[model samples]
Target: MARWEEIENEAPEFAARVRSLFEAGTNKTIATLRKDGSPRISAIEAQFEDGEITFGMMQDSLKLRDLRRDPRLAMHCPTLEPPKENPESGPGDAKLAGLAVEVPAPPDTPHVGAGFFRVDIREVALTYVGTPADHLVIESWHTETGYRRKTRA
Candidate 1:
């Protein structure tokens, strides 16, 4: 398996983009099921560092209680949420898409761990199909496992 430092440190361009994406501090909405089987969701800050994703949960938050009973969690981030997008987009493509090349074949990233129990990115899919001007291009990034901040290095 490729070490986190090897991938992030050896490839400066890739490293730069990863840092930027995580640093962008895009809203991380985490949804987890409670012990009673109810749904719990919240918006918080998520970051990729060292070798995993990190998130903070307050002591009094219901999320914290749920985790104690059921540690599983999920995180969601969309490069292009809308099925149909306008020609005039935003400032950039998040640039994060470029770095997604870290994967060669499908499910390219195999070593994903429970690094974000605070949140998890379970799957990723990409699509680029449409007209020339108003074409729809979608590149999704995701992971399955999750972990907590304090426990991860």
Candidate 2:
């Protein structure tokens, strides 16, 4: 992770939209590699908090097992229409980060994946497209813990 001193800041409205949309329901595509170099994919429901987005699932599931070996992971939370296919394709300025800590299995649920994963959003890229021509493009960063602006300068 880079030092706090050097980071880009995101606009308030952008952050707010992310927070709101995530709350409703976004398809999270978690990509991981298998032992034989095969690809493993899982689509899951993700919830976003002030600091991180959480995913709950079974402990004995395939995804959790894959995560144990390869910590390096990439996840895409896409916002789509009711069908939940073909994401709306909004601004790419989404705060993203790699997650490490995976919570222990939940007692009642008895699910191995019934826990939360935190993403310390390092930065986001915003792409603006309109009728005439693409004009606005911005990259910003935020504090790892909460969605606080790190590029406010």
Show how many residue pairs clash in every candidate, following the order shown.
Answer: 9, 5
Candidate 2 backbone collisions, by pair? 8-141, 9-151, 57-113, 59-112, 93-125
The lDDT for every candidate, in the order shown, is 0.44, 0.50
- Model 1 lDDT tens row, 7-89: 44444454444445446557755666788898787775666655645555554577666666666655444344334464333
Full-model lDDT, candidate 1 = 0.44
Cα RMSD (angstroms) for every candidate in the order listed: 13.3, 6.9
State which candidate has the highest lDDT: 2
Q: Give the lDDT of residue 149 in candidate 2.
A: 31
TM-score of each model, in listed order: 0.47, 0.58
Model 1 deviation from native, Cα RMSD in Å: 13.3
Residue lDDT tens for model 2, 65-122: 7767764455555643322242234433343445535665446765534444544334
Residue pairs with colliding backbones in model 1 are 114-146, 114-147, 115-147, 116-146, 116-147, 117-146, 117-147, 121-143, 122-143
Global CA lDDT computed for model 2 = 0.50
Model 2, position 147: C-alpha lDDT score: 35
